[model samples]
Target: MTNDRGTSSRRIFAGIAGGFLVSTVMTTPASAQDDPQHGLADIIVTAQRTEGRLQDTPVSVALLSGEELATRGISDPAALQGSLPAVQFQPVGDVLANIRGIGTFNLQPGADAAIAYNVDDIYIAHATGLTPVFFDLARIEALRGPQGTLYGRNTNAGAINIITNRPRLGRLSAAAQVQAGNYDLIATEAMLNLPLGETVAVRISGATQKHDGYMRDGHNDADIYAGRIRLLFAPDQGTELLLTGEYSNQSGLGAGGSSPCLATFAVAGCNRKGWDAYAGNETPVPDDFRSVENIGINGQLAHDFTWATLTAIASWRRVDYASLTTTGDANIPFGDFGYKPSNANQLFTGEVRLNSLASSPVQWVVGAYYSREKMTNRIDRTFLSDTLLGVSEVLDRYRATSRALFGQVTVPLGSRIRLTGGLRFTDEEKSASGVATNYFVVPAASIATGGAESHSGLTWKAGIEADLARASLAYASVSTGFKSGGVNQTPAGFGIPSSYAPERITAYQAGVKNRFLDNKLQVNAEVFYYRYTGFQELLNIFAPGYLAFYTVNSQKARVYGGEIEVVAMPSPDDRFEASLALLDTRFTRFDLTSFGGADYSGNELRNAPPVTANVAYQHRFRLGSAGELTPRIETVISDKYYTDAINSVAGQQASYTQTSASLRYLSANGGWSLTGWVRNLENEAVIYSYFGGRGYPLAPRTYGVTLRFETR
Candidate 1:
């Protein structure tokens, strides 16, 4: 890290420290029982596959409840960047999440994401399905660092768990909400719960949204519809069953790109354009409309025994989508790079586990997991010029299978210490077959290619925790992570490798959780370091008269980071929260053997900002015999970062800050509420991603109002 960047990180941390010191010295101790509204509320989580308090879990994780999600208007993972420490997002038609500088480097089919995403304990195999599962959720947990032992494969970065609200045994309740905003935006959501019998209950929920484009010519809009149904059956106190079904459809003038010249230094050959302008060469540029449809069904059964509990889970899901998008040469006119791709995927998963009862002195869990996925896809390409015209079509089929066995045990030592250990063994296999035909060639040419690959590995974790005080705990752990390799679908005779190697990581982490001022103030801090090997890197080869995509393994790399979070509730009406994260990453040894042995060692990893911070404050006022009003303000700051492995000037994003505010009013009976909100008050055109010469900017200034009602 540079001296300037280091100094900037220190200054941010200093500000957070200042606030903590003031809250500690100025506030008087008060019992939470007497002043219930002045202290933080309890948050329950299932990070370790069981119910537990957030502060008691021995890991670095963040949680956001359903109420928080609705209040902040956060319906997808892309909107969770600054709300959590050591987290970031990049949207390239499909949303991708990054934690602690590790994320997906390959966007091709059959490639797995570093961050594992799960909905109600069921793994989601594809990125296109992540958005729809966020609705009607109870809470979402983001675990930072490696979570390979319990989560199994493809969790080198971390994991996200989305827990939904289940049916109540005997209750009748309903809620509805409507929102209207600028850009002709409108959204509606509703939910209902009903009891069928003494042992059966059902819940249903749906949401729909539409909005105009953010582009200058009204492109890049959003249209989404989703619904879910859950049924719960409890035969007796020892046995329970739950079934879930979901469907969603998303269609719009999807993601559009702008010229990078608008965000970087002006160059002689660059074409400067506005952030909202589309960067393309086609005359009367066509809208990049895309659509996705998904369906899923899952079931869970559990039985409690005298000594242990047995649980089983099974799920099936399908996703279909189509898109038309511009490729490289986004800034050059008359470029021949565009394509339309259509795909369908089907997946099935099953798991069985057993764990000791909560009263057991030595808590233990054992589980086995299995998953299979099949995909079919077709791509149509067009390359036209003054001298020649070429059109090509490729049809491909792919399949993947995975199996795992995992176990974890925790034992108490003495009176204030505990030891934990875990292990998981995973086996994965992938195969692909494809045929390509080119029409504009001399007499037309056709080629075929197919290959298969398999990988197996063992991942483990061990940790120790100690209670320093009644309201404080300290813990440390070392863990390993794994992501399987896969085959490429490119045709033969192109010198493209058929497959890539698996990537692995060893992470060392330590943290402390503490509450002060009579439990009204909380402060948590953690630091982590990773030794990464066989890093998979996706390469896009663009040359004269040729275009190719491939993946290769980088020899080695290193990543290190730290985070601090503070929350203070000085009084019943005032609240404050702040967080800061610092990161440093580097590729220790990497060589581009396919590109004439070009060495790229010592380069910083892409999207790994050296400094990031968030700060927020809120205050509530009581209206005598009427209602209550609350207002909030927040700001997020990020340092300059690169969007490509090469770190080109065109892919660099400068430091920027964004601010948002909201005012909410609630009825005296707590049955209805209204909120007015505004985001990005400065209308800053902050670049989030770069594709060749094309740049994608974050949303500009937006304002809206929401009205909600419910039965209490």
Candidate 2:
């Protein structure tokens, strides 16, 4: 452990820090020759405001349907990385997100995720808000590239849209599933749908999961519960309405970290632990269990008229998250680094859109959006010796309000080409106030930091699509995205410029979608380039003997990438799919005034892997007198990636591959089934992230069996 004391006043600090930070399907059609085999199903998506065929959409999107999730056991957001190219969710504390090298690394108060999350067209306000649990889902879509023209702020990267199953007025159904796995893992899920009278229907669903920690050190365990209720009404021929309420709760032991290199990142009295032998030998034992609670209500209404169709959506959500975990060395007087944090956020959003109903050369969609969010955060940093830093408290409160109007129109040029354009004007206001207290300060009163700021901008998109031979399309587009700036609560007192600058991105992309071999095989490919200004990052600074968390800004960055997706249905019983993501990222310019004479130009962005690929194959066979049997296998491979802005090997996740397999058996009626699965089949301790010199290795090999029942 190196113990050289450095000046604490410098703005840039990366010597050490805390927690970790930042898929699907298809369907198309069948040609004449494909009649002998099961055709790839036609998929419908709402990537644009209106429902349309997936392959015909101009944008790039990935889809995973309800059946896929049920088969793969992907019930949470963290499990989504392996199934989707160029998408990631890792590093615990902050649950960071990165899509095509665009994501937020700093998770200070008021900082929003670059990749936004939306449920049924209603936006989720904060990055750490409810990552909607997957149960009774219709489908999940990841819209890649800039979507600011329609989705609004915080979508500089892209957006994730989740749609749940809607109630059926004339159907009654029930379903249930149970799973048990290694590490004492147990999970249960159930759903019910009922019809009332002739005009109404209701649906209810619930899920719960519990698991023992994989490590003897007693970390990385999970306990979760979630439920939802929905009601649908169609009182007349032209009017429809749906109401929904949902809740999610989580309790678990947080992730553990290990120092890859004992000298560079570890402090005195800290023995580096490897991925195989994780230990809390010097950590704060009996650490407070991390927990999260989320509650939400959503409503949707639609009416048809002679001129257009009007759709209105309203939503409200409240989220509370708390965590306590180990961070740094136990020996350094002020370096124990274990801290406690709490965050509570409340959000309300409303949107209304009108779509042209009449057939015309120009079809259009226009909408208005409004949202407000209130957030409060409290961080209590612990020091082994209070005399070293003299302080350990932070309380912050922030509010953000936004309003926007957007419209898009499309015109078909004859039969071969279509031209489309869209624009949005957004106005946002933000205010924050916080207090920091330390023993170094003479006065008994705490230091005050907070202020008011506002930002507004116009983001737009333009694209052209050309129909090619054999149900294929080629598209090109250019778009711009926006993310508002925010204030920071720091121990540097109130004198420093306590807020960061906003971020802006301009992206250009081109892609091709094709279906060949009698529509039995599908291929989609895209290439994109991005220019970024005012990138935000968190700096862990140690001034003399004291430390504080601060949000910093960088000048500019450049990122370019491409992805390819392929799906093949060779026969009615066999399927093969693969996806690959290639990214090249660099900071074009990075020189901060506060960090004395340091340059980070040419460093790769954190959490952006240069290369990643996934492959999977499944085969089904008929069993005499029994039913059907399926065997499936998958693998994910990735190149090395960094976890910090400085790009140190000490904070990097080395390249590795993960393999998984499953075997399933189903009854003749398809109403009941049994599945056995195993993940990380190789049992390789692949590290994906790091925090406070501790590495977060991927979970070891896990095998489980699942039984499911359903009725119609």
Candidate 3:
């Protein structure tokens, strides 16, 4: 299968490249410093091992600058989905990030996300610790399709790479900002850059944000708090070194819970008895507290060698978190029960690579990577009775080790064309164990399960790009991606395996990128087709007697989609941008013999939205000789999406539209800024997700203000 796919991909690549002739006419020139309305800028991305213009790189990539991100109020990964048409960001928990509608459904301790995340080339394994924190950054690159060639391991959907600003030599700068608004919200951020000596520099940044939640509590009112810090160091001319470290902590009550209505008194569309209790009847329950602590250390070293540069990176991260959740069935009248889960994870990664300068026709890079992680999780279920006694205890442990070798080369056919190819081989091993004990049961019984799995695969990519003109380019590529498989521990009756096989995807993509109107307009479009084999789908098997849910794998499938983005700048201070995506995904061959003779072929993939769109406008004005103000507005829209693959009509989210606006005041020196913003302007009753027998309500209308300062 692999060979056949490879051959077909090669043919497509050759045909696309051979059909178009490279043109040297200068089309439009776009600079990175310009706003979206001014035109599309030359997007430099690290899709390969090093930074290069996106048009010259033979891969499907999306670039979002820091200014663009700030305009949309995207401080975290979940909010970033609004910027990319081809990607979907569904928030399950702190660490759970779904990309392209494929990811881990359950936020269990041992589960892994389908889409991998990398920050400055360091892979982050835990989902809960990857939450967004605004920082000084260069650019964000979203490599679409499969990124197996460069990222390696667990990048079945794609990869999101974040690059931060490094310390500068012989420069001193500082900036600060503050904001206040509805819900008594306040936020502040500050940064300072200082050069210690002729060859040494230090950069330090920190921020703290707190907001009173939108939901009215039945008990005491609650608020959310988050904070982070980053430190960087660089010394010398021939050699450059950077070190970054950050941490975030949060504590708040879970969203409101609903009570089930009695069968005899249930109404078709009216609110149930307990549904309006918080708003009318009594004081809210005591707010639950959730806490998280994360610490990460990353270091990068680069050496200039005239013809090539040698780069090495090392990183270590640790996360500890605890949360208490209410678990009563939403529609039932059962007493409220509490489940507390605590987890700790540690990860270490190292990478070394060498890249040849673009001056050489044969620009190339080779690298090796190693990663190891250890995780532990504990869950305790307790009844909210007068005694507050514990009912059950569940413990899980996971350990994984992965290593890979990867290399890529780009050969310039001439001034107007280039060819790129890359390959990666990865080996991974994982082991997991779980124990569940029910102390409140009759005899105090306990169940134990353990499993281990190892997988190895080779992924490759090939592409060709033709520069039609300075402002326009076209490219085609074929790539592959893989996701590691692991154990499934439900109960004996579910027939779920103790382990599963790894899933793989082979993808083909073609696209065009262009800038026109003297860099005032930029447009990009791409189409992709993917064949997925041995797909690991999570099946929600409800135990007959016990109230439990189990997940397992499905079968082969296919997915195809197209994305388009346009950015136009009518004037230097006015910007407009829009993006749209359409996707068709289906399960081509699904056989469910374990449960019954059921065929799931031709079914729509779960949580996959058929259409998504976003639009935004921003204008900046000079307030006076020493001040400026910018006001921006944006909207995001999505079509109905299924929460489960069974294609059930009831388990779907209705199409919805959300709008947001922000206003900012900046000092003439650009060192300080103040901003006010509001989200979900319509107060739309959005539903983020729904499955099984319950629905997770979306965040309500929220308003906040923020202040920031910076130095360079």
Which candidate gets the maximum TM-score versus the true structure? 1
Q: What's model 3's overall lDDT? A: 0.67
Better of 2 and 3 by TM-score: 2
User: Residue 482 of candidate 1: its Cα lDDT?
Assistant: 80
Clashes of 3: 25
lDDT of 1: 0.78
Poorly placed runs, candidate 3 (over 4 Å): 1-40, 217-235, 254-287, 328-338, 381-393, 491-493, 595-599, 622-626, 669-671, 710-712
Q: Which ten residues in a row have the lowest lDDT in candidate 3?
A: 268-277
lDDT accuracy of residue 701 in candidate 1: 77
Expressed as tens digits, the lDDT of each residue in 405-524 for candidate 1 is 999998999878999999999989999888766665677777785688898878999999977766677888999988878877666666667888888999998887777777778888
Candidate-wise lDDT, in order: 0.78, 0.75, 0.67
Give the lowest summed-lDDT range of ten residues in model 1: 268-277
Best by lDDT: 1
Q: Tell me the tens digit of each residue's lDDT in model 2 across 436-518.
A: 76654456346676777798889999999987754677889999987778877774532345777778889999887877778
Q: Give the TM-score of candidate 3.
A: 0.86
Candidate 2 regions with alpha-carbon error over 4 angstroms: 1-37, 255-277, 280-284, 328-333, 358-361, 386-390, 440-445, 493-496, 594-597
